[model samples]
Target chain A: MQLFRGLSGFSLTPTDAEGRVQADLLGRLLQRIQAAGVDSLGLLGSTGGYAYLALAERQRAVRAAVEAVGGQMPIIVGVGALRTDEALALARDARKAGADGLLLAPVSYTPLTQEEAFQHIAAVAEAGELPLCIYNNPGTTKFIFGEDLIARLALVPNIAAIKMPLPADGDFAGELARLRARTPDGFAIGYSGDWGAAEALLAGGDAWYSVVAGLLPVPALKLLRAAQAGDAAEVRRLDAAFQPLWHLFREFGSFRVMYVIAELLGLCQLEPPRPILPLAGEVRPRVEAALQGL
Target chain B: MQLFRGLSGFSLTPTDAEGRVQADLLGRLLQRIQAAGVDSLGLLGSTGGYAYLALAERQRAVRAAVEAVGGQMPIIVGVGALRTDEALALARDARKAGADGLLLAPVSYTPLTQEEAFQHIAAVAEAGELPLCIYNNPGTTKFIFGEDLIARLALVPNIAAIKMPLPADGDFAGELARLRARTPDGFAIGYSGDWGAAEALLAGGDAWYSVVAGLLPVPALKLLRAAQAGDAAEVRRLDAAFQPLWHLFREFGSFRVMYVIAELLGLCQLEPPRPILPLAGEVRPRVEAALQGL
Candidate 1:
């Protein structure tokens, strides 16, 4: 499937203070992403605060997303959990609720062995019965995917793609080539760090699984398209406009800065689930300024 | 309180394939720790797989533990959760279920800011009402408590102690001195790395929050007593006997090793909740060998 190969815009699942998914608000956010003509919509991902939501709430978010923009674009749902059974259950719920694809993160409370993570991902991929993306987010999940593990996973049935972190050494071309050589044909490889996305796409990476695009899709799309066209100059120009926002994402964490972005953009104002506090009032001015050009 | 300042044994929670707590088996494990006269019972700490259990299951676990050993020793229940409100609710649940104290790790998916962690711990302390120990486990939770943050938490009401990871520099005396200087008179500080427990205690740590003590309480208790009595030779001798087990713990995580230890001792054999698979079949012989002379 080509579901994981383009500008996949992530969207937040608005929830009340008690974490019940605010379906209408979530629908509206999805509608925005669909209207902007992004390639896919990622629901219940890190930006959606999936880890903070209970299974019932996550199912509710998926159902709301499907109802809002089910056919408008490919709806890729994040089905990651600390428990493998929980992830499988979520994957079943997502497919039943009408999601078109799945993204599984190796979420663990205990730092997992690579073999354990491999089995967990393989189990979910087999159980999902939907194309799955390996969410290689070592930053939040803390389980780094070794090259051998990724190669092995790429061969697993229903495992279709990967969403990589920005390479520590910034060698996107080198990493992409190595992965491509091992992975079977048409296995999509994507990148997620909003700041490094342009370079990833320009380096011939297949997708940009974006967080900023959750709120501001047009600018992110412009950069993605420029990279796709192999116009490095145009991509850099668009990326420069995003530098200020990217700095805020890095400084305050993209997850927190995102709430501020949604509020400033007049979409909806909701605090992230607690234990992750909202950005301070003082940081709002900085967020406001970061939104200048875009 | 005195609850935070002694050998606190953490036990494995024997759960079935569905993760339902086996009350009788759990009670059997608790009895062993209690019979050995561990100063306190740390129910549902990391070694207990508290992260994998649902709140209802954790409540069942707390009730079972209290029934087994409530009047015999202080029960410090782990109330760590990804969400702040959930942790507060768990704290309330443990207290109502007859817990004598609380242990909280800043469990997070979105690696928490120090300010966020501080407010979270403070909120739980206020809601918990029982004396709470800060579970500063950066390895498990990935939320490193800055010295400044730990010092700040020490000043909060009802916050009684801290359970620390071993220092990279192995400077327990320096770290303990710095923490004690900032904390109030009796703000207890303990260490959890079982391999380092003897040294931590020998260097004057207030408690050894232990995992091996969950199964082999007799030998673990002996080590703790030696450390407490300032018998360096005896402490070293006992610690030497535990070296093979400690080596296994370092090779495989202590959490995974505990399950094998349970089976070897004729306790109920249970796999850790998956996606944490049981140790390889070959590793069992090594576990058997590690159990010698203890």
Candidate 2:
């Protein structure tokens, strides 16, 4: 199964002002990725704003996405919550809603000890009873995993993959080689930072767990394929085309910028939930221009 | 109003394994703070494990806390949530439950803009219709408040105080002076790092929003009183006795150590919710020793 490999497109979970999951709109979003033939659908990942949605809404999102394109591609649902039991409950909910795998980030209010994180991940992986990806997203989750911890987790049941942040050093080859040497055979390794995906993929990362592909899967897939084919020049051309949007993503946070991209694409007109404002002022036209030649 | 002044003792809201609030145990904890004659009670702050709770559970904690010590001392409730609307709801809930004031940390999943944080705080302040404290805890909230931003928030109606982490340089007097110059008159500026309370209080900070005061109110009160009286020698003596526990708090987060303290004090045996494990092994005897000299 290509469940944890290749280009995994992450879709946003659209919601009204009250934060209710707009299931139909979400279906529309998922359909684009399905038709684009991305390897998997990452429903309710960070881009999906799973952290903002309630459990029922998250389940609603998973159900809607599953019905939209369950068999067409593997559906990896993000099941991260601040509490262990909550994440476990979300894992079960996603599985029952027909999700194919789980993505768990150690979402924290209290900075966790290494032991706490290991126990939490292991317990969730056990209870989830589905293939899982350890979401090493320190930017949002604020829990940095030592390579030792990640290697240890790689040995746990159902813990089949990892989605890493862009390494600060940008030495993707060195990092990938190190991780690959430690993790088990066929344990997928993916990159999530959109700006770094080109290098990560070119360095032979197992997958590109992408935010842009959620909105622009065809172009993103083209870039991914170029990297897979070792066409560094072609990859650079496509990556250059994405540079402006990547700038916007880095500046405004891809979560906020994706909302603008959705509206610009004429796909949906929605704002992120409160405390995360949508981009206003000069950002819109920049987003329009960013999409002009893509 | 002394609502946001002097020593505000924070209390832990005990919960069962499923994250249900133990209202009676919470009330018992609050009564100790009240009986010790602390200036105010900070309910549902970080030590209370507020982030681990559901909105309904958080409201239940506030209502129980207010009922336990409503008129006896000012009850300042922590009303932080990931969503702005959720926080507004919590602010209103705290007010409806008879809380005297509100403390809001810019609790986030996505890192927020300064404008977003300002707008969120303002909206909650307006809706809460009560004095609120900016919980300037970058350590957990991961949202740093700039001096300019703090000055701007000081102008927001009903936003009356701030609870700061210990400054990186440990220059309490200099930081207090700078913030005091920027903020309006009578807007309280306090600190929460228990190890720094003596220095902070002696430096003329308006309050000490204390975690140790939550369970060990009597000794904490003595330390607060000595600092307030400008008795440097007495404050030093009191602070030294607290060194062992403060050492434990720094080594293991105070949230984990508090459970051990509670167990030793014969108050309650409840563990912190999962993902924040209890301190174990040699730590128990160390805690016992810390209390012996105190």
Candidate 3:
């Protein structure tokens, strides 16, 4: 099994006035992710694209991402729901959409035991027959995947990798070490941290998913390339260059802010669907300034 | 407009084998809600039986609750979604199901701004044409309904109540007081705290919603009625009586434990839907013992 490497992040579609899929903007986002030289295309994950899209909309997103990459890069699509049946349905949709693999995150409505987590993954594996990356973002899921759970999941078939975003703060180093130790040889482990991308990469992460890569691909890809080459000096240089946009996103929220900055940079233009409080009057300008600085 | 008083908890449907809606159990649940003398019934909200059910199952849950109540008690249903259109559709469904009111909680898939929150409530209010309680459970919604946001929502048509849950273990006493102060004369505020219910009731909550109430209505109602009457001594007595059950729920997890305890008591003999891990083996017996104590 090959480990997923380099930068990978999802860009979401903005809904239209009629509440239908904004297909064109989504296609543009796929182009942007490709231009960023992303090693893999992550579709339908929470960074923007997948959190609230309907089944059909999600399918459209997956297809758009794949089509934009023109089969050059693999697309990892997110499939999650409170009910396992619904999640199974999503897995079916992901497969039908021609996704290369699946990214599964347990829904937060119900907590899962470590054993159940293993079972949940196994069932999805059986249903979809697709390679999987267990997405472990505890803040969103509210259930942390402990070492025992990772060890159990490692033994499950068709689990290609793990996309882990440790909370920026906390004593997560121990958990990180445990994860690294427990991850099976065939399964790759990737990191997702707005600020800690470089550090995680330095600390043995195989890849870092980048939001900046959605809008500014070359610089992000350059950073990933440098990090993979074990050039700490060049990695820092690229990290410094991307720091302005990073600081802007951190100033706002992680998921929504990235959407706002993407819109500001002309990567794609559309409003986030309702419920994400929009960036205030001065904030968009601030994002623009940050984008310019970057 | 009138303040929502009495029990504002969900009137859940009992499901049968194959995960289908058990109309008989649903009817029985509604009858029990009425027998318990709860002032209001919330059907098809997250807890009221639709969380695991299919769209048709959810509609049946609403219809069953409405018919069982037979216009004897007010019914407020939760209509939330990751999509605005879906939430609007649910609101309209609530109206057709003969709901007395609607409970609107913004879904995170479409994260709402304060203004969008107003728009969402306004759309639902116009569609349902019923009294509404803004269910502010930040734990589920991922959006905190602050006093200012609540103040803005207070202007929405037919918004009759605010079901605000205390956030985290933070110092919300001052914020609660502010929320109450900002409420217009016709609006009421209720509480939902599995372990903190007694204390939350004492802290100016006009009424409270309880999962425990579904199984043990007599005791749950008695506790709340005592708390409402400002008889601290009676409140203590009833709370002590129910304390073991409450403690078990808190010590274990929410909802799943509630469902298991219901099954143990023969109130609702259904296992929790998948993705919600059941109680640990040792924890199950403790819950059983606590129910026996009750």
Q: What is the DockQ of each candidate?
A: 0.85, 0.87, 0.45
Candidate with the larger lDDT of 2 and 3 = 2
Model 2 lDDT tens row, A67-170: 98988899999999999999999998888888899999999999998899999999999999999999999999889999999999999999999999999999
Once model 3 is optimally superposed onto the true structure by TM-score, how far is the C-alpha of residue A92 displaced, in angstroms?
A: 3.4
> In candidate 2, how many Å is residue B207 off?
0.6
lDDT of 3 by residue, A176-239 (tens): 6777677777577787765778777766677676666665677777877888889989988878
Better of 1 and 3 by lDDT: 1
| Candidate 2 Cα misplacement greater than 4 A, ranges | none
Candidate 3 collision pairs: A12-A49, A36-A217, A274-B110, A274-B111, A275-B111, A275-B112, A276-B111, A276-B112
> Residues A167-262, candidate 1, lDDT per residue (tens digit)?
999999999999999999999999999999888998999999999988999988889988888999999999999999999888889999999889
For model 3, residues B113-222, the per-residue Cα lDDT tens digits are: 56777777777777777788887877666666667878877877788788777657644466567776887775777777656777777776765766777666777788
Model 1 sits at an interface RMSD, in angstroms, of: 0.7
lDDT of 1 at A209: 98
What number of backbone clashes does candidate 3 have, counting pairs of residues 3 or more apart or in separate chains? Answer: 8
lDDT values, one for every candidate: 0.92, 0.93, 0.71
Error of 2 at A147 (Å): 0.7
In model 1, which regions exceed 4 Å deviation? none
